[model samples]
Target chain A: MNNHDRFVTDTAADIAAIARTEGWLVPPAPIGRIALRPWQQAVFWGLRIYIGIMLVIMGLGFFHVAGG
Target chain B: MSAETDILAPAEADRITYTEELEARLHDRLRIQRLRSAPRGLANRLALGLALIGPGLLVMLGDNDAGGVITYAQTGATYGFSLFIPLMIPLGFIAYLVQEMTIRLGAVTRRGHAEMIWKRYGAFWGAFSLIDLVVANILTLMTEFIGIRVASAIFHIPYLVTIPLAFAFIVGILVFLKYYTWERISLFVAAFNLVFVPLALFSHPDWGAIGRTFTGSGWALPGGLFSAGFLILVSANIGTTIAPWQLFFQQSCVVDKGLLPRDIAASRRDLMLGVIGMVAVAISIIVISGQYLHDLPNAASLGDHSVLAGIGSRLGHGAMVIFALGLLEAGMIASIVITASTAWAIGEALDVPRSVNISPRRSLYFYAPAILGTAIAAGVLMLPHVPVGFLNLTVQVIATVFMPAAMLFLLMLLNDRELLGEHVNSPIRNVLSVGVMVMLIVCNGLYGIATVFPHAL
Candidate 1:
């Protein structure tokens, strides 16, 4: 099989093993704290807006509108 | 099953081992929620996204160092932003294309650029590339120090005080911080470059002129002394947008940060954002310069300091002060990154010890290049009539000429089935890369003609 197929197969096995090993599972509180922190939210918003501005500028760039 | 199914099968087992190490490395941040009875959710995806963000962003911002800022500044001051505006679009795409390959190569091979070069390309070719990088890096590092010196001079801070202090601050950060902390703190510093955006508003330029620049009609202006000077600025602009050290730095950082295939998409996204950020800040420099300094009767004679001060003055004292602060921040940020790149390349290539995780005492080999690079650059900046302008111009030309050599190695390694396999670049990527390489060659040729025979036009 190809590398992609091999990757998928190997990853499936690893996930299966991880599921079987209850010790590896993270609890929900830690998950929420890590994922929902205010600063973390800020990074998300910041990146999103940054990308949006770029897309608009890129559109303008295509039309030869952006200043050098 | 074939005998290859046996656990001892060399290739398959090696692949398995590689994947395992990569997964364990990523495990801390991968954060897969149990979907079986627990639930499949978006939170898992978000965690993965945050984890992959560093390498690309670092590479993009890293490319827009002090050298790049000055190049963009010069371009705007000399040319008034007409033809170069559209060029940024293609250049940003080239930055993304070349960098994305490094991401794949590092993730798949688990080797730094230096190590791969040493192994596959043989010692002669490897040493050649290494020497070129080290020399170019030393020269470029000097430019960063010069930037800090010039920026400090704006506020009447002497170079003697600023240069050594800047060195100490950069060494302190790299020596004390681990890979993750170093990356995060550098991003914070890089973020300050965006201060130029609001500063750009003070230029009071005609938006129509800016818009007209992109339409190609504005680009058809007469080619004379003005165009020739602008061409030099364009060469500088290209140099700032694409640099050789960037590939080495990002690939090493990816391996150092333990990015895996799963992290690749987020890394690309982060890189795309960084490119946009870099280009926006770059254009802001040009706009600020073009609006204010371009009109100065003695703008050329005003020298580098006058040009910088001219931009600062237009933005009001508060803005200029902030711009100076941004200069210090951006210069320091680049110093840390470039110094680290030098250290890492040396360590990884020579098989000496490396990584910021090791104590300074333990990783002296790694820290040595960084410390030495900073000292030499600082030392050079303190000297009289140090050929700052000529060297700055030469740095851009040299970088453009040498860019293809580095990009070639990256492309070949990425395309090698033994290394990247399915991760190899798509055909479209190959075409785009070739196009970028050709464009660089032609631009560098024209740039050489303009510089060597300035009066030819």
Candidate 2:
């Protein structure tokens, strides 16, 4: 088998072993997709606003220097 | 059916599916295997502890990069150890708090900070953060190269030789070595940073006076504390200790090291040790510079290269050589880390293969950005009469603009219960994180104003 295929098989076995040891009924798998909750989206927007204000301040500083 | 048969046999035997959870479990297995085989004794515990200590120690030493060393030296020469020595204590705490969150996040989530941000915050913020981190990292890498040039020149080594040598050394390790080997080599380079501590002893600084400065009026500024120059130095020191790249670097490093939740206490001990070493080396530089160069004319104006030469003249040539070696190692070690961080962040953001364990052929996209950054920085330094001072100022400005944004993301991530579960920020942690975030914002604002309106400061 190729290296990538072998890596996958080995990783699957390893995860299975760990899940069994920890008494997890179902073994965890790789995250195929990520969808944030509503609260997370709100926090994300808050960050965007913070970054936007910072950019504006930076622009003003640029203009102040230019006008001088 | 056996667990392995149930999980692995039914999975497509011909193809390997690589996922974040699977990768984390594989690391868990590796740690478990090591523990099973190691003999039970004090020696075994020591070995295990040594094995677990890389990410935190590397991050702290990486903070004392070439630019950071120069800043400390300038602090000592201009103001002496009175103000900044005491200042290092608080800075160390800040460093620990900021970095410890990364450890918990990495262990609990099993994802790098970049991947976590992307998964939770969506593409706009993820892309924005990636761009900011990459730009800052490349610019910072240039300063490291400039540092390499200055230290090499002290020994009369040409730029043509030093730049390429640095590139080869940095790229060779990443491309060929696995994570464990790469980390150990990097740690050895980091230990050289303590060369300053012994050199401090060589300077024969007045211990009684140094002690008095700690308790007596040393906290008071020689000139007014709010002077433009003092504020600029303070900003630089803050910029050096806490940085945008450090958050990305440490979180990714812990993930790469495969640390699990059970390893958290050992990791904290590792982090505290690193902080102590970092502060010791920083204060040592300040003390040595204060003793020998404090009274010299133009001491404040002299760059790090000249300062080293001046200190060498007074203390003897051997001291200068050791200083140059330390500077070289600082630049080299930080270049390895910064470049790797850039690579890891880009790889995770793009959903590409991103571990050091993958073959070069499979992980080309993962490794390319880092190699490209190192190459570009090395090329820039080889140009004739490069404006080193302007590059330094640009690094500080980029850091001032980017650090608060980085800290905000870290604080938000720490509070996310979905990501951290029981490991989410506690009340005290929340207060400390917010307090640090506010302090960084205020400091960066002052630095921003000073940069724009130099005369106003």
Candidate 3:
């Protein structure tokens, strides 16, 4: 429950019912953790390579700006 | 638990709801949800839209920061009523289209940008992204202080006095205010960004000349678009228009403001308003300088203090003061929003409780980064002869350089069928998003070559 504020009271369940009747869930579901998929690491590495190149070029360009 | 056939008994109704710890964010969000079921009328609809509108407006306006103001000013001063004016309109639409994805991601997923990146992509990219965001934020914050410092100087206030004073106000509001209160105060300050609209009119910009830019003549750059300065300025323009922090900030803001999927359309309208404000302010700043400083011998290199002084000399001290005040407001609002973005990204990535409602007493960790980060940025501002104009433009360029990574992560998240369900990016959006990514890379690369070669362009 570290990520959740756990509380229980059947009284608000009546109030929650009102929201449910209106096509809403009073307390919505959380977007919890997910298992990393197969292609994710590949994609992340590709991102790293692209960013690494951009960073190097940008660093040089910025250095030129600073120096000149 | 089924409701009784009639109203609840007095004894049962007396029981307090959510006794363990009803988070302020959740409580506030639920209150807005109640407003959604209000009777259909213009007033009620307007109220609901206003309540759900913070994240997009904050992100778009927050981007028209110290760097943005200076970059737009420099564009007008250097190129004068060129393609840049018409360019800003399309850029605004592109910004809207790009940022609109974050609304669905945040609303449907109910997770912050950093949290999604961390959980979905794993901790390495998350930590890297967090670091990049914090460092960029600090550098960007220093540029903000420069804006403040320059504005203060216009009024004869020293940096020693103004920088820390602004810092105190920033930290004070952050440590004290809750989400709704803090957001409203920020919005009020953001309204001053429109000061540029009047400044544009005050500059007496030629309507014919401005309109003719849409014709072929305005498309031509004086130094040619390939020139080093022109390329860098163009890249800076792109950088300012669609920044990385914007992606992180808006989504996290949407999550923090507790926007549900039901509120996405309203949030899109909010984003459109933001796009309009952002483009208008940018064009106004460009026109203000285009009217006065464009023909100056050193217009391209005027920087903050000199540009205002240049306008003051022509348009009187009133215009100078107005421009400086706009910069001051822009810097201040961007500083506040950026600080929150940094803290929120850190908190979410690290799994600390992240909300504006987290009192400093309960979790000093939440507010510590903001205070320390601003302190460091302000400390940098205090140093002698910090080439802040170049620094500001450099911050924008840096934003352009690493923008691909930010966009990549965002695109991936938005396309996540598991999380966004029916809200995933459409085929057309995919094409546009990829095009934008490529455009960012090309802009950065072209600037790089131009920077090194100097005369190559």
Candidate 4:
């Protein structure tokens, strides 16, 4: 068998064996997983960056308001 | 024929059992692993509940800043506590509606207010909201320091001396502590605000008068100026109870607290309890001031920062000391929370590294705002001609104006099906939210007109 097939076989067998020993059954891998698009991740973090600059500006404004 | 059929069925049976048992085992293993990582027995869940509670409680108490206390006190002294008590009834519900939305939005989105605005509305609206928030936050922070300075003057300390020290202490606490630790420390400080409640007892005002005021006599707004000023102060009182910063702060804190979607119910319960505590304490302040000081000629003048110096002479040194401590604690804790919220919003909006969890060097964006906020607020206090009252009034007006926009964003996020799925706000919540937004718009409109034409409304 090829290396990829052999590795899958070994891993599945190990999981199955462990399950049996622990009084459990081995389940199949999930069919789907969540994956954000590159652009989405970029948008999410970009929003965070804008908020940071505002906070710095707001904080400095305190000195002017404090009137020291 | 029977034996052959039995053999075929047995083969199929074995295949089915193997698949079913394997699936069960995998599920069990995953469950075990999760439990091992974070156990959810009674003890563990209770501990988590306690830990999750700090931010909600601190944010609510922070809402009851020193200005809030004095406003409530002045309301009582001026109106004798009748109308204000019932007003708090609706006010509490309003507080709940507004605050609960924040908890939901925060726990679900895992993004702060500024961040959401930046993403959804673009930079123009984002910058507008940020500018309003920053201006309002700085102004509010000034009021807190003013409370500190006024309270210090009661004890014969210079405002300058007290202001710097208070700033240093607030910065040191926020800088050294993470979110969890900062919350815990702030809660301890918030507890001191209960001093006002007991001070109510020391006043020994007629319980009968106080009760009658609530149940029978209407609030006295006979004159024109009194009526106008009363509405303004009422707006201020309610406005102070659930300002826009609270929406940003509490929600950001929820996300930072690592609350999952499953924790939404718990977080709401936490927020409701906080709203109750906040309104109860504020009413108590008003009640005390009304009962004891209503007969005095300059009762409303008690809110005057300059005249507040006579508090000790009137209330006895012991009572004054406790009141002063309460004032100091309220202002300082508010300064910390507001500053932190200011930092969190900026960081969240800009996608910069922020949070008390990260070290100062790594979290410069987070800590920088907090440091700058305190410094400038302290500096404002030192200035000779800062027009502190106008600044305070401007902050309230700004909050009143921007409130509708904040509420609009909140309502939109809460109704987002993609984000909330089945957890979106129900019909009743939707109606209540819309009603609140409408009321806020009216309040702001009237306020604007009144500002422009002092005699009209």
Candidate 5:
């Protein structure tokens, strides 16, 4: 095996061993690339809408100050 | 199990192994090995202490950025050695409480603040945080460069010479050095922040009056407690101390430093020292400026440079040069930290190589945000008639606006039993955190209203 893969395997074993001693379960690895969970997606969209509103308010403040 | 199964299973075994936690554990083992190999003596103890000094010292000194120093100077010039001087003492405790939690979180999770939020909470809160952090970091970098420019101008150095030189210096340290070396150099720069303390001594302020102000009713505002000007300065002070970037920066720095659970005590000591040092320097600046410029007409109307000039007139050119040097060092150190915070947060969020230990080629995403932010901020300072006053005010406003959200995520993450396990914040910590959050929200709210209606004061 290549050095990088070997290193990864060895390190992973070490962490698992440590977690077992600590009585903690190692969580399962995510499949494929990292993607947001369903709940996270909802939060992302909610924040986006909030950010949009904040921007409008800020923009209005800018105009008001300049106009004044 | 077959050999192939053993080899491949480990990688597919668990998420924690694939994450930075594995690397953190390896790094911790290496550190312990070094400690074992070392000759047991004062030198060994010193070496261990030095190793634990980076993140906390960097965060606290970096907290006293150009904007903060400028704010303190303005505070002294405006109100003298009244409430604000003594106010910094308790603020230091608040800073320590918030930042110590970051160290614990970093040690326990072996992940940066941004990474924790993204993986645990989801993308919306993550993006919300990243956006606030990146925007605030850039604006704050502008304030740092403004400080550099102002200090340079005091020495008759032009922006043409200052901007590129400062940029190269910041980028060079970040790009060339690994975490260990980078931190030592940063601590060296951070030491110069104490120049203000000695300069304050040279100012020869009335110590008796300064002491009396601390204990007496000088905490009361002349224009009453809820005055608009008073509230705005209080918010600015809070904004300068407990910032959004600090949350990301300290956690990432702790992770990068490879601190383990055993090292948490050393980390706390380092943080306490940093807090003490930061407050001392801030009070020194306030005392010096407040002593000289307190009675000056329109002292509140004076800019940062004007305050320095006033110091020059009172204490001579030498004292002014010392003040300018302190300001320059504050900007340079904070610029390094602010840039690193941005790079670390973005890299962590994207799951890229984020530690300063990685090679430049491997860590391009880790370094790009910082270098770009520094370059753009330095470039902007070159423009003529930049609305610096407006920009500085806006930076504070942005910081205050985003701070509550950042603190909320931090508190939530600290309390997350799944992630922090046994290291979750205790009841007393939660009470203190809530108290700090409430004060921050009220101050920011009052400051916001005051900004919108200046005549309210």
Candidate 6:
């Protein structure tokens, strides 16, 4: 085999070994899901709310700039 | 649905991954092996280190984008060698600490940040981060083009001419060159970011006053600390320093460069150098603007073209030409790196053949989005009276709105013990990281409020 093909085959083996141990590069399913704790959930939701509000405020301001 | 087919699926999947990784990273892997076998010496180690210095350096230099240069210029002109110059030192360390996590994650996990988020967090949060990244990238790319468009004015080039040429050059390098060559070309381009250094020296800044900023006198705010203008410049500086595109770009770059766990220390050293380069250039621009442009009419609100014009009149036409080149280089280099960040992230999330190495003929779809995104940004900039300046404002707003969440994701991934094993963030690291994160989020909030409600501040 050519060096490049050999490299691919060798890498395939190495990846398979790693997949068994670490995880796949493009995992079909997540290895595990992070179930957020209460505070963490709150923080995430707060950030979401913050993004929503800022987008609205900025959106209005944007129109003002465009219109102005 | 047969059992045999199911059984073969994983092996096939592994092979596909192997093909992609090898295609993208074969050169890097070979270099690592050669470095391993080569005789150990100071000169050899330096060679090896240079070989290993792609992701961190690119990301840090990449952070000092067109928008970043303008922000630093604004800081210097408005605040004038005050707190902001000294502020850059800690900001540099913060950038280092934040980016260092990505190196560890990339080296150990061998997966890009986008892939990691998609896999561990599932598609809901995955899509959220991806949309944010892509949207932010498109909008930010607009500002880069605008910078290039305007900065080209210094050379008597019209925006009509500069924008198309800039667009073609950015697209050509990204689409035509593979990862290794692409990075080298990019670094060569990025080195021009330091042109600000000479421009600063030419300005003949007061050495004692500049030194005094670090010696506790720098805290004297020329503009009141609570002024809306001061707050805006500070937020811009902070936003430009630590950014979302940075996390995706550096991590994917490391994975693409095929860095193993053994390369982590060298990568950290690489990241440190990037931070230093990023900050020093930032300060240089600040010094240049502080010396020449600060006293110009309404200096704080001056655009890049205006800053260059100011420099020309004050420092001479020759220095202005150099400064303009620096500005154009900032936009050009940023356009390249940020576009790659988008392509890499989208390629990872979609599970397509994504890499700098992926031949356009084989997997053209992988390259289309970034190129298309760039085209859209450039197209928008070219349209008649398109309110392109407002779009730059939108870029800052989107970036501010997105940064806190980006930091949160980085910290969570670093603390993922199952993935990182013993390399997980230590307790002290966690505390410091959380502190910085909280501070960033607060600044982001203030950035939002100050931007949206000019009267409120």
Better of 2 and 5 by TM-score: 2
lDDT string, candidate 2, B360-398, tens digits:
777789989889977888888889876543235336545
Q: Could you give the candidate ranking by TM-score, starting with the highest?
A: 3, 6, 2, 5, 1, 4
Instruction: Report the candidate with higher lDDT, 4 versus 6.
Output: 6
Q: Candidate 1's residue-wise lDDT over B1-457, tens digit each? A: 2211342434433343222323433232323322222334687556555555777777777677766776676666666756776778777887888888887877767668877777776665567567767877887888788778888887888888998898988888888766656777888887887887887876577777887788864565445533445554565577787778888888888777766575577678988998898888877877777666666653322335666667666656776676676677667877888888888888887777567555676667878876887788888888976655444555665666567667766776777676676998888898888788777766655644554555665
Q: Report how far residue B78 has shifted in candidate 6, in Å.
A: 0.9
Cα lDDT of model 6 by residue, A1-68, tens digit? 12354344334443344443333344333357676677866887788788788777657756765665
Task: Compute DockQ for each candidate against the true complex.
Answer: 0.02, 0.16, 0.23, 0.04, 0.12, 0.28
lDDT of 2 at A43: 57
Error of 3 at B378 (Å): 1.3
| Residue A12 in candidate 6, Cα distance off native in Å | 14
- Would you list the C-alpha lDDT of every candidate in the order shown? 0.66, 0.74, 0.79, 0.65, 0.76, 0.78
How do the predictions measure up, each by TM-score? 0.78, 0.85, 0.90, 0.76, 0.83, 0.87
Candidate 5: where is the Cα deviation over 4 Å? A1-68, B1-33, B36-40, B453-457
**What is candidate 1's TM-score against the reference?**
0.78
TM-score for chain A, candidates 1 onward in order: 0.43, 0.48, 0.49, 0.44, 0.50, 0.54
At residue B170, candidate 4 shows an lDDT of 84
> In model 1, what is the error at residue A36, expressed in angstroms?
52
Per-residue lDDT of B365 in model 6: 70
* Model 3: colliding residue pairs: none
Descending-DockQ candidate ranking: 6, 3, 2, 5, 4, 1
Clashing pairs in 5: A44-B124
Chain A only, candidate 3, TM-score: 0.49
Residue B79 lDDT in candidate 2:
77
